[model samples]
Target: MENILEASGLTKRFHGLVAVHDVSVQLRRGEILGLIGPNGAGKTTLVDMVNGTLEPNAGDLVFEGRSVRGLPAYRRAHLGIGRTFQIMKPFPGMSVLENASIGALFGTNGGERSIGRAREQARECLAFVGLGRRIAQRADALGGPDRKRLELARALAMRPRLLLLDEVMAGLNHVEIEEVIEDIKKVRDQGISILVIEHVMKAITSLSDRVFVLHHGEKIVEGSCGEVLRDPRVVEAYLGRRRR
Candidate 1:
């Protein structure tokens, strides 16, 4: 299968500290790739570079057979890359539909030019993420899980070919996590490739076509979920020693 996204020798540094070191990854079209690691493991940093939130000091990023090394975040978005922050960012004062409309208004290929069109797209995205009932609510008024849905909806509103989700399942209870997992699968089923950063083991394991494990700013393993999870190095890096 052809890779939708590919990074080679990706490295990022901040003030002499290497936040991400020599990382390489390939994400195939229509596949969900789970990125798992401990906190401070540079998972977010790596995604930031790929999404154009941060410039890599060294590496090559290719999307859909084109190099995107010097592209700005907005340019990348225009090329169909959309991402959600680990920290949810909503237009707090705006209605849920309006907040999502921003994504529709400024996303891929310059998004929808008409406000009415954007709003229509926003409503559909909200419904897709199971947020349709809350469309009239203020974005800031949403509870935790709903806020996560808003984030997903907003990203979907961008009409992206590739979606980068950062920690979207954090703070959800088991049932809510399962709902979000289903929603993610639905999103992927629509032919959007996904790169998910998640600490929720069950959700990631079940959802990812493949998993990449990172530790201390480096990738330790990449393989099918069962293989990666059972790797002793991965267990030590994140899951710790098995309990007797």
Candidate 2:
């Protein structure tokens, strides 16, 4: 499969502080790539740049073989890029269905113009993420896991080509995590590529085709989960941090 998204020499700076430095990554057409790191590793910064939430101080981005540099978030969404924030934000005043409908209303290729068509597509996305039963409930009333599902549903309703999932399993029990792992796999089965940023070791091992590691905003290593786990640098990074 060809590369669906590519980031070259990406860098971000906050005043005098370097947040990300010269990082490069590629996401293939139909693969799940795991990005792991400790806190402040710049993983979220990289995703934000890709999703057009933040501009890179220096870098070039290519999506679907076209340059995407400087595009706004809405433009990126129309270009088939979808993302879920680590701290998800669902519309508090809307029903679950209404919240999801917002995606279909403004998704890829300008999305569905008719409200009825958008709602129909939203329902399918909700069902896929197991939020179908709660479609009528207020978005603010959902529990942690269901909120995660709602986040996924909204992203899926956008009909994206690439999904940037940032810790979608956070705060869930082991059973819920397992379900989410499976659900992500199912999402990839639909021919969408995924870049999963997660701290869960089990999810990384179970879902990643290849794993990449970042530390202090730099790419330290890239390989399979087992390979990354055994690397002396990665081992030291984790163990040394724990000792502090």
Candidate 3:
């Protein structure tokens, strides 16, 4: 299959500390690629680079066969790349439907020109993520899991061809996690390639067709879930160095 997103020799440095170092990864068209690493492993940093929040010191980012290293976040969103943040922050003082409508207003291909059409798209996304009932409620009034769903709904409203999800299952329980897994599968079914950064091993194993392991800001391994999980490097990275 063809690659939808490709990162080549990406590196990010802050002040003097290197957050990500020479990392290269790819997301295949219509596939879910899991990115797993411990805290401070430069996972979010990498995503930030991809989404245009930050620029790499030495690398190139190719999206849909074009170099998008110079594009801004909103420009990327308009170019069919949408993302959800790790910290779910819905638009303050806005209704659930209004919050999601922001995505459609500035989404793929420069978004819907009409507010009415945008809200219509938002409603469909909200319903898709089980937030249809809360459309009229204040975004800030939502609880934890609901906030997560709202985030997903907002992203889905963008109608992206590639979705970058940052730890959407972080605070959920098993059942909630399972629900998100199914939702993500449905997104993939819609032909959206996804790059997921998650700590939950079960969610990663269940959702990803292939897992990419990162350690100390570098690629440790990338393979099938079973193969990567059983690798000694991955075990040590998650746990600790095993004593002989």
Instruction: Return the TM-score for each candidate structure.
Output: 0.96, 0.96, 0.98
Order the candidates by TM-score, highest first — what do you get? 3, 2, 1
The CA lDDT of each predicted structure is 0.93, 0.93, 0.93
Counted clashes in each candidate structure = 0, 0, 0
RMSD list, candidates in order: 1.8, 1.6, 0.9
Worst 10 contiguous positions by lDDT, candidate 1: 234-243
Error of 2 at 22 (Å): 0.5
On TM-score, the leading prediction is 3
Tens digits of per-residue lDDT, candidate 1, 121-200, equal: 99999998889899999999999889888998999999999999999999999988998999899899999999999999
Superior candidate under TM-score, 1 versus 3 = 3
Worst 10-residue lDDT window, candidate 2: 235-244
